[model samples]
Target: MAGHAGLTTHVLDTARGRPAAGVRVELFAVEGGERRRVAGAVTNADGRTDAPLIERGSLTPGTFELTFHVAPYFEGFEAAPAVPFLDLVTLRFTVSDASGHYHVPLVMTPWSYSTYRGS
Candidate 1:
């Protein structure tokens, strides 16, 4: 990892059976009725960001969202539709422990996506 440990994410393009590179990822902090941008990064060749999206000391106990720009990625591919079934794939999760490391990964295709807590 290139960043201080806190929160991380990985993305896989199941449709092509490869790591999703150049995908945009955004992190948001959800506070009550308002959502604020915390951090953002693009995936590398390995389907992972160069740094932790939320660095260690910056994380707190609250709700957060990781939105992946999927539609644009598939647009350049030959098999994807002009208007894909999925565009922005957002994962909303809560962090109850600021001291803990959270790794959330997405395995996705044009029409489907799945995610879970990662090691």
Candidate 2:
């Protein structure tokens, strides 16, 4: 795996117009209808994991999941509603190129969220 494949993520809070720090993120590998967690991390001040969830040379071709804990994050915001609209946001995607980089970015608010595969 000389040209290793890896995965990274970034979280942005649109409501606050800043990075979503302290957010808990989890990575899971899906296989035969069973899900196994691969890694867990907390978003840093820059709204990014301290290290790639899937480090270089470890990624493989398969379906994977990234879960973001949002309710607890919104709880700290005074502008958030009494009952948050989002709790756990999970993005399920497949990695087809084992030698390419995958960057999943999450942009979210209390009521809405979006994600995309970036460079």
Candidate 3:
């Protein structure tokens, strides 16, 4: 992972079959039982980060958390007749190895969401 090692993420609006644009994402690192914000950005038109969440040279083996704000994204959707059940979605995972690619893809709707390791 020396060349281009980093963390990346994407969100697919399963309900709409499209990228989740304008979603707010926050990256945090766990330290001594406390969470610290490392970096953050909003998803682009394609629902992918414009830059890697964590760059290669800055990567470390540890636990990380990604919080995605999904409330506003579903507020006006016709399918969301009521307030969304999930407002702030958080995904916590570990980076045991920093030399490999880590792609976290989230499939989500106004009421629920799921994620997994992606290629």
Highest lDDT against the true fold, candidate = 2
Question: What TM-score would each prediction reach against the true structure?
Answer: 0.92, 0.95, 0.94
Please give the TM-score that candidate 1 achieves against the real structure. Answer: 0.92
Instruction: Put down candidate 3 lDDT per residue, 29-117, tens digits, no spaces.
Output: 99788999999999999999999999876789999999999998889898885767889999999998888878887889887899998
Worst 10 residues of 2 by lDDT: 1-10
Tens-place lDDT digits, model 1, residues 11-72: 99988999999999999999886889999999999999999998877778899999999998
In model 1, what is the error at residue 117, expressed in angstroms? 0.6
Candidate 2: tens digits of C-alpha lDDT, residues 47-115: 999999999888999999999999999996888889998999999999998789889999999999999
lDDT of 3: 0.90
Q: How far is candidate 1 from the true structure (C-alpha RMSD, Å)?
A: 2.5
**Global fold similarity of model 3 (TM-score):** 0.94
Per-residue lDDT of 29 in model 3:
96
Cα lDDT over the full model 1? 0.90
Best by TM-score: 2
Clashing pairs in model 2?
none
